[model samples]
Target: MIPIADKYSTFARFYDAMSGEYPVYHAGRNIGISLLRQRPGAQVLDVGCGTGLNFSLLQAQVTQGGTIVGIDRSPEMLVQARRRAERNGWTNIILIQADATALSPAEIGSRIAAEGGRARSDAVLATYALSLMADWETAWANMVSLATPEGSLCVVDMQKPVGLATVLTPLAKAACWLGGSDINAHPWTAVKRDCVDVKAASARGGHLQIRAGTRRAGT
Candidate 1:
């Protein structure tokens, strides 16, 4: 049998517990909401979505019938996620025990069919999870693979601020390797993708929102 947590399995169970106490949780949800405003009926994919924490926040902003998909590699985390959805009556939520670095349309299609035949999502949202992805670029590409041309790709993550983004980038890189990641890079290494960059309003004491770009026909 495979280890449930490749890099974060152990951390997954305590993720929400740690994040609940995390002061950034509030600002994080706010940024995701703000970035997703332009997309209607947005099919938001919370990549590495831990315990479906962002589902409630996105559920309200997207169209009434909108769906929110949360995918993570840890089954332990998914256990809690099942409870979160059931408790919140978040019928729109679907939690998958999968890897973020491998997210793609084909994979998502299989999962959807297993559920009930839903189409690709309008957008993808990766909160606080990008920094931990095994392959940030491929993960970003995969999320883009799941979005529609008219939809948006919203990313919410923690930053070390002006002096810190640069300083912490390498540290994150090392951590990624030790955590079983060989891609050896952070998602924001370049931000050179064809998409546009929308900077979220700087909340003095909250998470940061970054709208990288709207999905453009198979981007």
Candidate 2:
């Protein structure tokens, strides 16, 4: 069996096409980014940023003056993300290839600064990404560490669908399995616990949970 990173590396070429962006996952992203509330000149971190799917929306908010730091573990995915940035004329993007779970906060902060971004971002977002990390809490802590003291943090991840969408449970499970994610991860619970003034939203019958909030002291 292919390792999870290898799976993503191999699938990078076809990820955007097969990732169900339009009819399904887009809603959570829209809400997550909105909750970030970043300013025009602020810097934002995109953890596990595959193919830069969130770039266009983030660029619109940050404008030409702001910077977007996109970090992913897969080189193949970063290639696609770089291509997307080039094709879209997005010069403010800095792409880093690193494993979020392994890298320390200081190391990543230095890397970001070396790549022309601020050491600490004004906002950080991980969408449909953390559930894949077995040590997702470590990733979440590192994410918060990379943010400014007063920065906003947002997590958008999957869960079992509720209400009418419960009928799609099998499909959801299959998708999560294929994607190497734990459908029961509930990664957003970290944000609720560690952050203040938390905001929450659910979409696609609770299959997607969106949580955003300001970083709390000592978090």
Candidate 3:
């Protein structure tokens, strides 16, 4: 079996098209970004930001005045992300290649500062990303370290459908399997556990879980 990183690297160019963005995953992303409520100049971090699928939506929220720092472990994925930014003439994007689970917050913070963004961002987002991590809780901790005390947080990921949608379980599992995600990860629970004023939404028959809220100060 192809390792997840290599699979992503090998298929980086085709990710956006084949990622089921429009048919299934896009709804979760839309709801997640909407819950951000970021200001025009907010500095936002996109963790495990594969191919920058969230860039366009995030840009619409932060605008030209804000900065977007996109971090992903796959250099190949980052290549596509860079291309997306360049194609859109978006100059405020900063891309970093680092393992979210293993990164040093202090070091990465300095890097973001060097790029003219704040050491701690105003908001952080991870969509269909954390579930792919083996130690997603660590990644979630890193995300918290990278955001301000009152920063907004959003996580969107997949699961087996429930209730009437249970019929789609096989399809959902297949999609998660193809993408190398842990269908049972349920990473968004971190938002509910560690955040405040939490808002929740689900799409694609609960196969997609969307959670967004503000990080509890000092948590």
Candidate 4:
């Protein structure tokens, strides 16, 4: 079997078209971005930012003066993300190729700084991406470390559907499996555990979980 990043490199071309964005996954991104509540001129970090799917929503919050740094391990995905930024005439977005779990905070910060972003971001978000990480906790730690003490952190990921949506469990499982994700990952739990004043939401019969909060001191 191919490694996840290598697999995504090939999948990057048709990702936006076939990733179920509109009908399924977009809801989580929308909710997650909303809860971030970033101020104008904020420096935002997007981890595992495949094909820049969160760019539009993040742009609306950060505005022209703000910076949006997008990091992904796959070069092909970064290529698509660059295309998206170019097509939109967005000059404030920076795309970097790096593995979230493997890179240290200093390395990521240095890369961001080299691209004209601040060493620490004002807001950080990961949507539907953490569960794909083999060491998501490390990624989460870097996210926290790369943000200011009181900066916002948001996580959006999938879980088994509940109630009426439970009927779609098989479909959900198949989707997650195809994407190389563990449906039960519940990566947002890290937000609850490490951050304060958490905001939570669910969509698609609880299949998507959104968690956002300010990073607590010493966490």
Tell me the spans in candidate 2 whose CA falls farther than 4 Å from its real position.
none
Error of 1 at 101 (Å): 1.9
Model 1 segments more than 4 A misplaced: 1-7, 20-22, 38-40, 163-192, 197-199, 204-209
**Candidate 1 local lDDT, residue 65:** 74
Off by over 4 Å in 3: none
Comparing 1 with 3 on TM-score, the higher-scoring candidate is: 3
Q: What tens digits encode model 2's per-residue C-alpha lDDT throughout 153-204?
A: 9999999999899999999888899999999989999998989999999999
Per-residue CA lDDT of candidate 4, range 1-219, in tens?
A: 777777899889999998999999999999999999888899999999999999999999999999999999999999999999999999999889999999899999999999889989999999988999989999999999999989999999999999989999999999998889988778999998999999999999999999999999998
Q: Which ten residues in a row have the lowest lDDT in candidate 3?
A: 107-116
What lDDT does model 3 reach? 0.94
Q: Model 4, poorest ten-residue lDDT window?
A: 1-10
Q: Estimate each model's TM-score.
A: 0.75, 0.98, 0.98, 0.98
Total clashes, candidate 2? 0
Could you tell me the lDDT of residue 81 within candidate 4? 97
The global C-alpha lDDT for each of the candidates, from Candidate 1 onward, is 0.62, 0.94, 0.94, 0.94
- Could you list the CA RMSD of all candidates, in the order they appear? 4.6, 0.7, 0.8, 0.8
